[model samples]
Target chain A: MEDNGRTARKRAQILEAARPVFLRNGYVGASMDEVAALASVSKQTVYKHFTDKEQLFTSIIMDTTAQVEGLTKMITATLDDDGDLARDLRALARGFLGAIMEPELLRLRRLVMAEAERFPDLGRTWYERGFERSLKTLAAAFGRLGERGVLRLDDPELAAEHFVGLLLWIPVNKAMFRGGNDLYAEADLDRLAEAAAGAFLRAYASPDTA
Target chain B: MEDNGRTARKRAQILEAARPVFLRNGYVGASMDEVAALASVSKQTVYKHFTDKEQLFTSIIMDTTAQVEGLTKMITATLDDDGDLARDLRALARGFLGAIMEPELLRLRRLVMAEAERFPDLGRTWYERGFERSLKTLAAAFGRLGERGVLRLDDPELAAEHFVGLLLWIPVNKAMFRGGNDLYAEADLDRLAEAAAGAFLRAYASPDTA
Candidate 1:
């Protein structure tokens, strides 16, 4: 059991080291020797943890999906708040932007999208596991809001899409193209979040409820 | 004057040939020799027209921005229609989606975004020239609609962003990640466009006007 625990710890250490290397160098340019060296482990141990560069890259991406769990929880907690719908949604939008617009997350996004052509399966898995999962959770929350007459939507899933679409489309595209996160100030993000929540409310809020 | 025309024609030819090569090989892998050979022009002629591969690539991207003029015209003509507002908006939405979702355009977008880190200026220029130009035109049209009391937006720019966000967030992201345009059928696109227009109307249509 102790040996197994030590092996798991070593594997985690390798993945921690591999993330920045892959982010910096991209898949084609990244070298196993560099990853092993960065991990302070021998190439054999790196190979023992991950069979090859592709496996290591895939593991790194797949592991990032776990971060979405925090977002899922945030969505549930924020939407479930029995407060002002607009206020709650704005806070949720801010949280959504804050989580997604992290420089590391944005870099990972760029890295995944940049290599999506060469690694179709990795791209698809990342989109499904990371992007779609969060959408699904938000959809469920919207459904609950609709049931309570807090919102008026024929389709909760579509509303969820609109909410995120309004919030993310401009900032994410700017970040993706500009290759940086400094484009938007905190004030700008807050304004964008407020605009998205306001638009969503206008589109879906129960006419009488608001 | 005839010699000047010929020079211009050769420049055009070189640019036309360079597009596919860049699309296929990306920035790092593309070669001037391949572009000249494909254009059936001499390498010396290619050099005379374009100083280097970077200049050739930049010119190709900058040239494509002219296509947005056509879209701007389309938006004005479609939205100015004296017919049903819903029908007009749906037609506009459909056109917007069809234009942006072209495979060649998607490929160009991927090419620009992939090299965004390496060529920050190129990416910024493309985003501003191509992407922002379209949004600004759409916003102007939405502003006209607001003046006529057809829409109820206090901010036409935000409304334009929401309109595009609703229509494009899902499809564009899917294309960016999956590296293909086959994810949606013609009917699916129509439905998406319809949904976007519906949501936009719900959000912005003058309560008494519609």
Candidate 2:
């Protein structure tokens, strides 16, 4: 049991250390030597945990999909209740914006996109496991809301897509192209959240509630 | 006069050949030798036209901005008329979607985003010249529509942002992450365009017009 715990801790350390290296230098440029040095482990130990650089990078990306679970849970908890749909949506949008805009997350996203052509499977898996997974979860939650008379929608899935599209398109593109988080102030994101939620509500809220 | 025309033709040939090289190999991997060979020009000719790889790549990106001029013109022609607002918006959405989804443009977009960190200036310039330039033109058109009571909006810029956010968030992200054009069929994009336009009109159209 102790050996298992120690192995798990070392794996975590290597992943944590390797992430910045990949984010900084990209896939082809990243080196296992640097990852070992940053993790305070020998290169042999690094290779033992992950057989190759591809495995290590794929592991780091797959790990991020777990983070999306929190957002999915937030969707169910907030929207599947009787709370004001607009306010709940704003809160959800704020949460999503904040989550996606994390400096680390943004850098990881850029790295993945930069390497997508070279590593097509990595990009597709990340999309399915992280991006599309959240949208699917959000769609289910919206379906529930529609049933409860909180929203009106012909297709719950399309509504979920539009809700996020309305919220994330501008700021995310700005950040992706500019390559940093400083482009948007907290106030700017808040206003974006409010505006997106308002627009979404105008489009989806029940006629009586709107 | 003939000498100047010859110089211009050589410059255009080099730019055309260099684009695919950069797009295929990315900025770091692209070679000037391959560009010269592809263009049927000598290495000296390539250098005489553009001082370095960076200049060549930047020139190629800058050249694509002229394409956005067509879309902006379409926006005015479609939205500025006293025609049906929803139908016009769909046509505009279809035009915008078709333009952005061109296989070559998508590839260029991926290349620019992939290199954004290393070549921050290029990314910023492309975003400003290609992306924001179109949005700004669309915003001015929307503002005119608001004045003519075709649409109701307090902030035209925000309205424009919402407009694209609704339209582009899904398909663009899908294309960006998946690294190919075959993921979405033309019928799929047409349906997406229709959905986006319908939602945008619901959010912004005047009550009487809606």
Candidate 3:
């Protein structure tokens, strides 16, 4: 058990060190020597943890998806309860905006997209595990709301798509293209969250509530 | 004047040849030898027209933005006239969807994003000339609609952002990550466009129309 725990800790350290390496230098340009030095391990130890750079990079990306689990839980917790629908939605939007727009996350996003063509499975897996997982969670919550008569929607999945679309379209694209997060202030994100929530309510709220 | 015409033709050929090479090989991987050979010109001629690979790449990306002029014109032509707003909106959405989802364009998008960090100015220029230019035109049209009392909106730019976010959020991401255009069919795109138009109307249409 002690041996296993030590292996796990070393594995975590390698991933933590390798993520910024990949993010900064890109997949093709990133070097194993840099990863080993950053992790404070020998190259042989790095190879023991991961057989190749591809494996190491994939582990780093998959590790980021764990962050999405928190978001999925937030979606369920916020939308499943009996509460003010718009208020819950706006808060949920704010949570999502904040999570996705982290500078590190943005950098990782660029890295994934940058390497996506070279590693088709990496892109596909990230999309399924990270992006779609959150959307699916949001969709299920929206479906429940639709059934509960708080929201009126023919398709919960489509509604969820629009919800995120409205919230993320501007800032996400800006950060993706511009390579930084300074474009929007905290107040700007809040306003975007409110606007997305407001538009969603306008589109989905039951007639009486609307 | 004859020399100038020949020079223009050779420059165009090099550009055409260079685009596919850069798209296929990526920035760091692309070779000027391949570009010159493909264009059936001397390496000297290739360099004569464009000083370096960066210049060639930037020119190719910027050249693509000329296509956006058609979209901007469509926005004005469709929205300016007093026509069926829903129908016009759906048509415009369809146009945006079709133009952006072209397989070549998708590939170029991935290329620009991949090189975004390496060539920050290229990404910024593409975003400004290609992405923001379209949004600005759409916003102006929506602004006109709001003033004409055909739509209700406090901010036309935000409305424009929401409009695209709703229309593009799903398919664009899918294509970008999957690295293919086959995920969505013609029918699927039309359906997405119609859905976006319907949702936009729900959120923005005048109450009298509602």
Best candidate, lDDT: 3
In model 3, residue pairs whose N, Cα or C atoms come closer than 3 Å (at least 3 residues apart or on different chains), thus clashing, are none
Question: What TM-score fits each model?
Answer: 0.96, 0.98, 0.98
Compared with the true structure, the alpha-carbon lDDT of candidate 2 equals 0.90
CA error at residue A8 for candidate 3, angstroms: 0.6
Candidate 1 segments whose C-alpha is farther than 4 A from its true place: none
- Give all candidates' CA lDDT scores: 0.90, 0.90, 0.91
**lDDT for each residue of candidate 2 in A45-162, tens digit (9 for 90 to 100):** 9999999999999999999999998988988898877787788899999998898888888888888887878888889899899989989999999998888887889899999999
Chain A TM-score from candidate 3: 0.98
Ranked by DockQ, top first: 2, 3, 1
Tens-place lDDT per residue, model 1, A1-210, is: 999999989999999999999888788878999999999999999999999999999999999999999999999999998888889999999999999999988888888888877888899999999989999999999999999988998898898898999899999988888766688889999999999999889888998877
Which CAPRI category fits model 3?
Answer: medium
**The candidate that achieves the highest DockQ relative to the unseen native structure:** 2
Q: Ranking by TM-score, best first?
A: 2, 3, 1
Model 3 CA lDDT for position B179: 60
TM-score of chain B of 1: 0.96
Error of 3 at A126 (Å): 0.6
